[model samples]
Target: MKILANDGLDQSGIDALTAQDFEVITQKVDQKDLPEFINTHQIKIILVRSATTVRKELIDVCPSIEIIGRGGVGMDNIDVEYAREKGIHVINTPSASSESVAELVFAHLFSGARFLQDSNRKMPLKGNTEFASLKKAYTAGIELRGKTIGIVGMGRIGQEVARIALGLGMRVVAADNNVGKASIKVKFYNNQYINVDIETEPLAEVLQESDFITLHVPAQKNGFMIGEDEFALMKTGVAIVNCSRGGVIDEKALLQALDSGKVRFAGLDVFINEPTPDNQILNHPKISLTPHTGAATLEAQDRIGLSLAEQIMNLLKNK
Candidate 1:
């Protein structure tokens, strides 16, 4: 059983895999060189992260590969449908990273609502002025308690968000295109919303009604599901959070909305471009950005690694 672990792993994890008697080849392959490395190894299982894209080129190179294991939830890095067509299995450790990502959503919520990043930045510039300057600015913040939150996708991560939101005393409304009339157990809202209805009622209704809106849909190339038309519908001073896949929300549209005050603050854990340079979102005073680390916590990483390891081992043994 030969495996290629391209995603970085802790020493403990590597030792555990060694104990499993699998010959694991560890290498650092950037996106450009991933296909060649896979081709050279003739690996049966390849582990990867969002940094390495497992597109058709990589898939085509690995004739012996049986499974492509994504170390985290989002398989956005892999061409899942194409892999399926090629008789290759794609597995992701979705549940493994749920809590970590959900917590990151809240971290963004806190930073976006409270302007933590900017305040931290401005602190060093102030020499004589009291820290009270930043304290006064905090007055614009609103408590998460007693706020209405609308979640666009209510999958595992979204459901976890709803759990935390309810704990914080925020009301929750969810809409997913696939799930129709399904009921969730969170006590924040009495009514369940469907995607069709959510789109019809002028998105602004949800924006106006919700103090915070967090998106958790998968990425699509059609320029995200949210755009100028949807942004125009948001209430002034609305806060937006995106921790799902990149490209699910239009970056430029978000910038314009932030500038116009249609979106008061945006907490973005993912972006249209991975490792996005010091762009407007990073420089924007009202936006909080992370380097796509929503599911990068130690616990999440270990869970995902172990999950992927098990799945790969299963595939090799069963096949």
Candidate 2:
């Protein structure tokens, strides 16, 4: 069996596949080289991160490929249903990066409240006293305790976020359309969606009421989920954190909110475009920007890579 991996895999992952007498290929192949490589190797499986797009065009090119494995969560980059229609099994390691993503949300929460990036950038190069004075201004960070945190999704990742938030003495309000009352132990609000407490109101209520709002939902099928109107509905000076898919929140709408003082701060680990070459928010003083490193931790990489390897190996054995 042959597998083509777009991104490099860790040593353990490589060893696992090699142990199964499977050949794994890791190359810097762009879209042009994909079809040829698939045909030449008679590739049975392909593993990719966000960098590769498993669209209908690419799927059409590699009919011999029987399975696709995404190293992390979010199949937005891959054409999942389309792959299914073509009789290709699509598997993703959703749990592999859950902790990494949850940690990122906490990281952003701290960065927003403390203004770490701004303080780091403004510290004087030569004047120690000036730097000391500037650092004092950033000390006005808000405490997370006693604050109401609203989680928009209550799935695995969202539940993890809630657990952490509760541990920090922050009240958690979850709103999910799919989850029912018995599904969650947390207190549910009245007249809301079935399971999720806090009476699942529209998105606007979540934005307006919570002291902090974190989005954990997958990407929407349309233009954008959180747009200008949604931003407008948010409480003034509310901080927003997004570690999910980039298009989930409208970047333009967020910028406008930041400009008008509607939003106090934003911490973004993902953007609408992966590897944003000309990211406008990189230098935004109020926005904390990371290079999509939510799942870049050593532990996360090991788990995701090994998990993907295991799934791929299982598919090969079953075939």
Best by TM-score: 2
Expressed as tens digits, the lDDT of each residue in 1-319 for candidate 1 is 6778787755545666778987777777777876677677667777788877788877886688888888877787789999999999898887988889889999988887787868877878872586787778777976789888888877788778877887677877777766544344544355853322222123455655777899887878665688888877667788889988888788889888888888888898887767764477678888887888988888887887777777766776787
List TM-score per model, in order: 0.88, 0.89
lDDT of each candidate versus the true structure: 0.77, 0.81
**Per-candidate count of clashing residue pairs (backbone under 3 Å):** 0, 6
Candidate 2 lands at a TM-score of 0.89
lDDT of 2 by residue, 1-319 (tens): 8888887776778888888887888886896788888888898888888888889998997889899988888898899999999999999888988878888898888888898768767764524768667766777788889998878877777877876776677877766787643143443358343233434555666777888899988888878878988887778888888888888888888888889989888989888876762356777888888887878888988998899888887776687
Model 1 poorest 10 in a row by lDDT = 193-202
The positional error of residue 9 in candidate 1, measured at the CA in angstroms, is 3.1
Report the C-alpha displacement of residue 128, candidate 2, in angstroms. Answer: 2.8
Q: What residue runs in model 2 are displaced by over 4 Å at the alpha carbon?
A: 124-129, 181-201, 277-279
- For residue 286, model 1's alpha carbon misses the true position, in angstroms, by 0.6
Name the runs in model 1 displaced over 4 angstroms.
10-16, 127-130, 181-205
